[model samples]
Each structure stands twice: as C-alpha cells, then as structure tokens.
Target: MERSLLTRTMARVPGPVTVVTTLDADGKPWGFTASSFSSVSLDPPLVSVCLDKGASTHAAFTTARHFLINVLAEEQHTVARRFATSGIDRFAAGDMETCELGLPGLHHTSVRVACSMHSIVDAGDHSILIGRVEEAFTSDRTPLVYYNRSFARPASNPDRAEQDIRASHIADW
Candidate 1:
C-alpha cells in the first residue's frame, strides 16, 4: 500500500491535539505538538504518544525520566501550531508552567497528564513512548480535535437534533 493511502485514511479519523513536554538533561524544557496520543492501560494508568525519529525533541523525550501531556483546548490552536513548527523556541514565550512533578505544562488546557517514562518501542518511522501517569489535571473546556488535517471541535447540538426528531415523531403520531 502507498504511504499516502495510509496517511489519508488516518486523516479521516479525528484525534485530540496535545503538546507533549519534557526537560532536557540541563533542565531546559522541550515540547512538540502531537495528535498521536492515547490511553494504553487503565490498571497501570499508562498513556502513549508517538514521535517521529527525526523530531528535534526526540532525544530529550527518549531520555527524560518524566514527560507531561498537555491536552489542548479548542481555544489553543495557536499554541498547538507554535509547538508543531520547527526551528523556533517552543518554550521561549513563557506560556508554560512547572507542574507539581517538576515537568513543563501548558496553562488553560483541557487536561494535563504528568507521566514517568515507562517504555519505548520502535515502530516504522516513529518511536512510541509509553508513560505511566503520575499526576493528572482536567478542566471544563472541550478538547481541540484534528481531522482532515485541520482543527475542529465536537458537535454541540446533537441532543437538540435528537429532540427535534422526537418532536416530529410525536406530531406524526
């Protein structure tokens, strides 16, 4: 199968946007935007995020003892884009804060998962980093989603549409 076919198929599936952060050996913070994040094991509270082998932050994360997954809100598209960009300093803007675990985290996000590095697996062109959740925080804001190569939000009125259908059925009866 062609790579583009796989890419296109995956693009159709929406995913939550996140900023994965970790500290370097010298204590400098590093991060990258990712949509390839998901829960792994509930019993161990493990989560995984995939990083390209060539990503600038790959070395820092692979060696770090802990990392934070900052799940972006719908209002944080700019922050997501900034982290995804290459060659720019991601933490230079001071938009991040130090979590209780001493890792970097983004403010005003939907959720933050501070995790200790559990394991690493090499897959195709990327490396999967599994982390055991040590601490987690969540907000009321809705998550930012990525679909078809663009950001989106969950539909807000599905319940209303269902009510409308119900009302119509009642009228017909």
Candidate 2:
C-alpha cells in the first residue's frame, strides 16, 4: 500500500485536535499540534500521542519527564495551527499557562491532561509517547476536530436535541 493512499484514508477519520506541551531541560517550553492522540488504558489512566520523528519538538518531548495534552476547543483553531507550523515561536502565540506539573498548557481548551512520561516507542516514521495521567481538567466547550485535512466541529442545531443528534449520526467508532 502506498503511504499517500494510507494517509488519505486516515484523513477521513476524525480526531480531536491537541497541543502537547512540555518543558525542555532548560525550562524552555516546547509543543506541537497533533490529531493522533488516544486513550490507551483506564486502569492506570494512560494516554498516547504520536509525533513525527523529524519534528523539531520530538527530541524535547521524548526526553521530558512530563507533558500536558491540551485538547483544543472549536474556537482554538488558531492555537492548533500555530503549534502545527514549523519554525514559529508557539508559546508566544499567547493563551498559555503553567499547569500544576509545570508544563505549559493552553487556556480554555476542552480538556487538559497532565501526565508523566511512561514510555516511548519507536514506530515506522514516528514515535509514540505514552503517558500516565496524573491530573486532568475538562471544560464544557466543544472539542476541536480534524478531518479530511481541515478543522471541524460537531454539528449543532438549536431545534435538534443532543440525544437526537447523537442517535441520528454519531457513531461509537
């Protein structure tokens, strides 16, 4: 199978946009936008995020003791784009704060998970970093989503009830 074909197929699968942040050894914050985050375990409360091997922030994150995953809200598309771009000062984009774990976190996100680095696994062209959730926070905002190479949000209609929307189109997958 061609890599491009596989990528295109995966693009159809929607995923929550996230900004994973960590501080380097010198206390300089580093972060990157990702849509490849997922919950791995519930017993120990673990989650995983994958970063491209060539990403500028990869080394810093792989070596960091802790990190925070800020699940972007629909209104935070700019935040997602900023972190995804290369060669930009992501932290300077603003709306960031220090979490209890001392990792940088985005403000007003749908959710924030502060985690301790548990394991790093080398995959084909990326590295998967698994973290043990130490603390988490959630807000009532709608989560930012990525699909077909663009940002998206869950449909909302004033006349349609939440349960109606879910029953009509939302799938467990």
Candidate 3:
C-alpha cells in the first residue's frame, strides 16, 4: 500500500489528541503530542501510546520509569501543537503542572492517565510504550480530536453541526 494513501485513510478516522509526558534522568520534563494512544488491557490496567523513533523526546520516554497521558480538551489544540514541534522548548509555555504520580500534566483535560512503564515493543519505525495504569483523572470536558490533519471537536448537535476543521501547523511525527 502507498504510504500517502494509508496516511489519508487513517486521517479520516478521528483520534483523541494527547500529550504524553515523562521526566528525563535529570528530572527535566519531556513530552510529545500523539494521537496514537489506546487502551491495551483492563486486567492489569494497561494503556499504550506510540512514539516515533525520530521524535526529539523519544529517548527520554523510552527510558523513563513513569509517564502521564493528558487527553487534551477541545480548547487545548495549541498545547498539542507546541509539544509536537521539534527543536523548541515544549515546556516553556508553563501550562503543565505536577499532577498525579508527580508527572507533568495539563490541567482541565478530558482525562489524564498516570502510568508506570510496563514494556516497550518495537513496531516498525515507532516504539509502543505499554504502561500499567497507576492512577487516572477525568473531567467532563470534551476531548480535542484530530481528523483529516486538522483539529476538531465532536459536534454536539449533528443536525445543525457545521464542519469546523481548524488547520493545524503541527508537523507529522
């Protein structure tokens, strides 16, 4: 299958925007925006997020003992873009606060999952970090969605809903 074709097909399937955060050995926070996050199990409470092997924070996350997954709210699209950009101070915005499990997390998110590293699986050009859920936080806010390479929100009233795809400047990771 063609890579562009596969990318376009997957883009049509909306995904929740999340920023996965972890601290380096020096205790400095590092993170990357990801839409490839999912629940893997419930018995031992496992969740997984895919990190591009080329991501700037890839090394930090792959070696970290714990991490946090912040499911961004609809209004937090900017935060997602900031984290996704390479060669910039993703944490300079100071929007993150120390939260559950003492990991940096974005407040007012739709959900936050704190996890301890369980296992790492090599998958093609990415590494799948499967984590054991240590704690979770949730709010009633609507989660931000990434669809068709744009930021979106679920329509509250489909009948009268208009397409609201905000063009995003985030580069593909």
Candidate 4:
C-alpha cells in the first residue's frame, strides 16, 4: 500500500509518451506529459487519455471541451519535461500554433490529433477522457518510442524484426 512501491511498479511499465494540449480562456496554451493514452475505437477514430483527479489542468480541460494529442518526436524530450513539471509555463516562449479549432497544437510532432470530448469515465484515482478525433496528422518522420522509462527510436531494420521481438521476450514482465 506504499505509494513509492506503487510508483516503482508502474515505472516498470513501458508506455508511449504524449503531451495533451488545450487552450485556456485567454487563448494561452497548456499541456502535460502523459503516458496513459490509448486508442479506443478505430471506426470513430477515438482515443483516450487519463488525467489525475486533482490535476491543475483538469478544470481547463473541462472548459475547453477540445484539445489535441501531440505524439512527441524523440527530439521533444525537453517539451515533455517542461509540461510535466508543476508551476511552470508549459508554453512559454514556444513556437506552437493554433489549430484549425483554435486549440494549441505543437508543431514538428510525430502526430497531431485534434479531438473533442467524447466522454469521461471515473476510474480509481483518475478520469478516462475519451475523445473523438475530428482530425489528425502524421509526420513523415519516424516515431518516438518509450520503453523501461526511457525514450527510444525505431529499430531501423525490418530484417531484424525477429531479433527485436526476441529481445523483447527476455524482458517480458
């Protein structure tokens, strides 16, 4: 029941990192690094992100009713760190532009997904915010991966696909 133990256990889980963004009333940008994101439905192009019950961004999220999911490029590690910390201006001195819907979306991301709130469900200590992707863009560039709590790049060789799978086998929880 210790919180540190819980954190350590969760840290062992390798998950892709994301920065969820929205605009405040004054049209300023806001974002936070999140690893708890997943595709919900393909037919509707839905995705989901979980937010801490007490996250400072929660109120803005509820009011904005719209946001974008920027799948980070590996080069965006600093962006991740910037948004993840508290009491920091996440978009300060940044080059992000407004989306078609006026939501703030980061440029040069692996992908930019503009969405509206589809629904919200309460979990144990978080809320699963489901979003209907109204639009999306995928960069021609490769994706940024995360594993064992670190950022990673593509394996590069498809001929080594078997080797990569085998390597993952040894590290299976």
Candidate 5:
C-alpha cells in the first residue's frame, strides 16, 4: 500500500476537526489540531484522539493527567489552522480559556469533551490517547469538518426531520 494512496483515500472521508489541549508538567498549555477524535466506549464513557509521535506536544499529551477535546465550530477554520501550525504560540489568539476540569477550552465550539487520561497505546508513528470522559459541553453551533485535506462545513439536510424519524425506527431494532 502506497502512503500517498492511503492519504488520498482517507482524505475523502470527512472527520470532525478538533483541537486537543492539555497542560504540560510545567502547567503550560499545549495542543494540536486533530481530525482523528472519536468515541470509544459507552459503559465507561471513553473517547480517543490520535497524536503523531513526532508532534511537539506529543509528550505533554501522552503524559498529561487530563485534557480537553474542543470540537471546532464551522466558523473556526482559522483556529484549526493556528493550532495545527508549529513553532508559534497557538494560544496567543486568546480564544481559549480555562474551563471544565481546569483545562484550556476553546470557546464557541460545537462540543467540548474533558477527559482524564486512561491509557496510551503506541501505533506505529502515532499514539492513541484514550480518555475517560469527565464531562462534556455543547452548543448549537455547527461543527467544522475536514475532508480532502481542507476544512469544510457539514451541509444541513432539508429533510432532517424525516431522516431522524427513519433513524429512530432503525434504533428500535
């Protein structure tokens, strides 16, 4: 399997854009923009996010006791780009503030999940950080998405209510 091929293939699959933040040993905030955040379990309320092993904040996140996953709103494409960048103060914009669990949380996000580090699993050149969700916050804002190596906003379906009814019927199974 060619790496570029995999990259291109995965790029077509849209994912939620998030900024995962944690405090380092020095209590300084470190974060990176990620599109690989997901729910892992329901019984214990687990969530997982991926971080590149070579990322500048990898060590801080892998060892941090707690972190926040800020699900960026559709209008926050700039915030995603800022955090994704390296060698600059990502928090200099001051959009993030101390929130749940005393971690830096990005404002106006569609969702925010605060979690305690549960475990870290090594996966090739990346590490999967699993967390036990401590709490979550949400707003009415639409989430930002990443697809084809670019930021996108999910389109609203005009027949959403009908779709939901159909989905509810499937849930009855």
Candidate 6:
C-alpha cells in the first residue's frame, strides 16, 4: 500500500489528543503531540502511548521510567502544534506546571496524569509505552481531539476532576 494513502487512512482515525512528556538524560524536558493514546487496563490503572521511531522524545522516554500524559483541552490546539513541531522549545513557549515526576503538564489541559512506565512493547513502526498511573488531575473542560489530520475541541463538556464518581458520566466515553 502507498505510504501516503496509509497515512491518510490512519489520519481519519479520530483520537483524543495527548502530549506525552518525559525528561531527557540531561534532565531537560521533551513532549510530543500524539493521538495514539488510550487506557488499556482498569485494574491498577494503565495508560498507553505510541511514539514513532524518529520522534525526538522517543530516546528520552526509552530511558525514563516516569512521564506525564497531558490530555489537552480544546483551547490548547496551539500547545499541541508547538510540541508536534521541531526546532523550538515547546515548554519555554507555554504556560505549564511540573508534576511530581518533573514532567511538564499543561496547566490548562482537560486532564493530567503522572505515571511510571509499566512496560515497553516493540511495535514495528512505533514503540508502545504502557504506563501505570501514579497520580491524575482532571479539569472540567472540553477535550482537544485529532481527526482527519487536524485538531478539534470536544463537542461537550468534560467535568473537571474525576475526584467524584458522580462527575464522570459513563456515557462521556
């Protein structure tokens, strides 16, 4: 199959937007905008993110056991773009707060989760990094999504903080 066609096909796979953040060997931070993220296990609370082989953040993540997943809000499209691109300091250009793991988490994101690498799977084109959630913070804001090769805001509101079960409607997912 043609690579461009395959990319286009994959692009249509609508997915939630997340910026996987990790600290480099030198203790510098790096982030990548990714839609290839999902919750894989409920027991013990596990999350997964897929990173491309050529991604700058990949090597850092390979050695770093801990990282943060910043689930973007619809308003954070610019943040996503900055992190997705190269040759610029993504963190220096944004307003952010550091997590306990020292990963940069977008302050305005709909949710932020600090996690330790549960496992790493060697997928053909990308590496799938599974994470065990250590701490999570959720906000009552609509999420940012990616679809058809572009960014999007959620159609509805996502309650701030899943601190209470009553706030997360099962129907939202």
**The candidate that achieves the highest lDDT relative to the unseen native structure:** 5
lDDT of each: 0.94, 0.93, 0.93, 0.81, 0.95, 0.85
RMSD, one per candidate, in order: 4.6, 3.2, 8.3, 4.0, 2.0, 5.5
Task: Highest TM-score: give the candidate number.
Answer: 5
Q: What's the ranking of the predictions by lDDT, best on top?
A: 5, 1, 3, 2, 6, 4
Which stretches in model 6 have alpha-carbon errors above 4 Å? 157-173
As for model 3, its CA RMSD to the true structure in angstroms is 8.3
**Model 3, which residues run further than 4 Å from truth?**
157-173
Query: Per-residue lDDT tens digits of candidate 1, residues 18-131?
Result: 999999889999999999999999998999999999999899999999999999999999999999999999888888988848988877899999999999999988999999
**Residue 38 displacement in candidate 6 (angstroms):** 0.1
The sequence of per-residue lDDT tens digits that candidate 3 reaches over residues 72-159 is 9999999999998999999998889999999999889999999999999999999999999999999999999999999999869754
Count backbone overlaps in model 4.
0
Q: Of the candidates numbered 4 and 6, which has the greater TM-score value? A: 6
Clashing pairs in 4: none
Model 1 misses residue 36 by how many Å? Answer: 0.7
Task: Quote model 4's TM-score.
Answer: 0.83
lDDT (0-100) at residue 69 of candidate 2? 97
After superposition, the stretches of candidate 2 with alpha carbons farther than 4 Å from their true spots are 156-173
- Give one clash count per candidate, in the order shown: 0, 0, 0, 0, 0, 4
Which residue window of length 10 is worst by lDDT in model 5? 153-162
| Candidate 3 residue pairs in backbone clash | none
lDDT: worst 10-residue window of model 3: 163-172
Cα lDDT tens digits, model 6, 1-173, are 99999999999888998888988768788789999889989898999999998887788888887999998999888888988998888888758777757777877788888899999999998999999999998989888999998987655435544444564665567
Q: Model 5 scores what on Cα lDDT?
A: 0.95
Evaluated at residue 28, the lDDT of candidate 5 is: 97
Instruction: Please tell me which model should have the higher lDDT, number 2 or number 4.
Output: 2
Q: How high a TM-score does candidate 5 get?
A: 0.93
